[model samples]
Target chain A: MEDDYYSIDSILSENQKIQCTFKVDIPDMGHLDGGHERDIKAQSKIQLPLWLAFILIYSDYVDFAVPTPFSSRVRNALNAEAKSVRLSALVGAGGHWYGFGKIIMRLLDDAQANEMSDLLTKTFRDRLAEVIDQAQHFAALGPAGGGGQSGDSALAFREGLEVTERELFSLAQESAKKTKQWYESTDRLRR
Target chain B: MALPVSLRNSITPPELELVASEELVEIIPLISIERTAFISGAYGPLRPPNKAKLPLWIAMNLKMKKKCHIVPPDWLSVDFLQNRLAQETSRPEFSEFPFRFAEIAKLLLDVASDDIQNSDKVRSLLKDIREARQAKSRDGLQKIDHSELGLPNLCSMEINEIRPFFVRAMGVLTHLTRDPEASSRRLDV
Candidate 1:
């Protein structure tokens, strides 16, 4: 099952164990505090192997969802490497690593930013089902059955379903609005 | 007489209407349709299970049932059953569970051999369990544990840096779902 889902073999086949060097442009951290600026400047050039890059990307998702002490170690390792390299050197060594990492990271960031949109889509799907289900349930009760007053009861049930449906629809719409907001924000970030 | 005429006109008897009884029966179909739709609709996207690895699949279902409280005492037994099967198949055995599949299978085979009359029933039950297990293996494969599966340490990255990678992974998932060809292939499986 894991093999089917991950296509680990395919990933391995595509894996390129190429040595890559890249210069990271470290913006002048004059605005930052003394130690922080120095730290940022020193760790400007980023160099990592392809395998490490994959691990880093995979770890990002895992860490985002569940923060653990182990995640901190990985984060520190990446940061420590980044901090150690000079910014000018990072910019100088442009290789597959830098290009590939940038593209993948950017795509990932876009998806993460649009999480609310995904949530909205899910909510919309759920609400649509809920509304239709409630409507049918009420209709099922019918106009007559319960103690000869089933007509009244059915009518009441229908009204209740209608109210609930309306509420769900409204909630879905709100979700949609939030999704739109997220989409716009993500679009800006991507740009 | 003129004064009493106004009061008499105001007083009227209530009317009762008899509704058709057949209309009541319509409720059953309505409820059925509603229930079906409700269930179908509840599943956001349906992915079919793979047919291969029938034994392992059964083990997973047994595991799921154990988790969901559908089968209580059987959870441990199911875990043992899975280990035994894994060992029998020479598959990569799960590290966590204590009992191996071979042991459980041997025990079951021995019990069935002892009770010749119930052997068929045992075989039949075993088959059913295997089918159930296979049903969920595909989904289980797709399921990713965000914490444990990936790189060792990720928590220390800044939120700004982390957000992008997370989005990318989700984008990949979304793309996988949206691809009609891939989805159809999965469904066919």
Candidate 2:
């Protein structure tokens, strides 16, 4: 369920508004407002989904500001958390942790990156440590059982689970691996 | 005493409810035909050596007819499942795995046990984990607090199997969170 929630969160988060400025001049780009059509004029600005923004930005077709969630406000808050509670709260609040991390990591991998890149790296490291710690606590529980029901009662109710939290754990590992790969590739490029 | 209201209400969204429903299965169909008509669309009278991608249901049907060989997913292998079981048993944290892994393995074990090299090992390992989780659930019912409901082994376990445990856990979570006096009484005990 956490996996589904995050997966949905990631998809929804991609649609969050981001400010973008066009560099090239092209005609008939959709209408942005009542009178003004989206002309691909130099220095033209607009708001678009982060997904589209990433593609356009990567292609050098446009430039954009990092959204508020990935800004210092978030980093500062994350830095303040003594445990994973805040990070879990962020996920619980319908935030896409991995999707956001991937975007920031990609930003860090950019050659002409700024101070925000370093901030992202630190935020991710701290957040990940917290997540791992939280997972470790859950891990300590062994598996679901031994509370109210016991012995024969437990065996009587075995039909296999419909969905498991395993996918959530798997997704976390996947995001970690991707982040690691992004770091390694960037390091390789730098050398 | 209890999980916060925000945490308790984070139930499964309908969109992700069918994670394993449409898993594509590879099959080498023995019979050759142009196409078969279904409500959605038409599919090929697939031929041998030319593998067809069909839904698990369709593949199962074809497998039943002896018309095709259902190629099992990579993770369904005996070695991998055994290794996964070992890792899950020994490690505190669960590693990444395919969604519906347990269900898929169970299906494979039922339909094509011979295909797997260590079928016996896989079967026993799964059984052991199942029994352990069931026992844990029985104990979990006694302890109502969220902290006492540790299910690390059930981390990646299938949901339906643990439904009763969660039902009880949720009831306890709701009861304790809504009523501080109840939690205080439990703590006092």
User: What is every candidate's C-alpha DockQ against the true complex, given to 2 decimals?
Assistant: 0.01, 0.01
- Across residues A8-59, which tens digit of lDDT does each residue of candidate 2 receive? 6456646556678888875777464234666557787777777787778777
**CA shift at B155, candidate 2, in angstroms?**
7.7
lDDT of 1 by residue, A1-191 (tens): 01244754224422423222222323564243344453334323333334454454444311222112113443354345422222212222321222222223322444542442333223223233433334334433444432443456434433333222343333333333332232223111211
Error of 1 at A17 (Å): 16
- Provide TM-scores for the models: 0.19, 0.37
In terms of lDDT, model 2 sits at 0.49
Least well predicted 10-residue stretch by lDDT in candidate 2 chain B: B9-18
lDDT of 1 at A28: 64
> What docking grade applies to model 1?
incorrect
Candidates' chain A TM-scores? 0.20, 0.49
Candidate 1 lDDT tens digits, B1-189: 665531332211110001110011000010111111232132112112211111222222322333111111132243444554454345332223222322233222332233223444544444444433322221232343233233222111111222322333233334222233443464354
Q: After superposition, which runs of candidate 1 have C-alpha atoms over 4 Å from their true positions?
A: A1-103, A106-191, B1-102, B107-112, B115-117, B142-145, B148-189
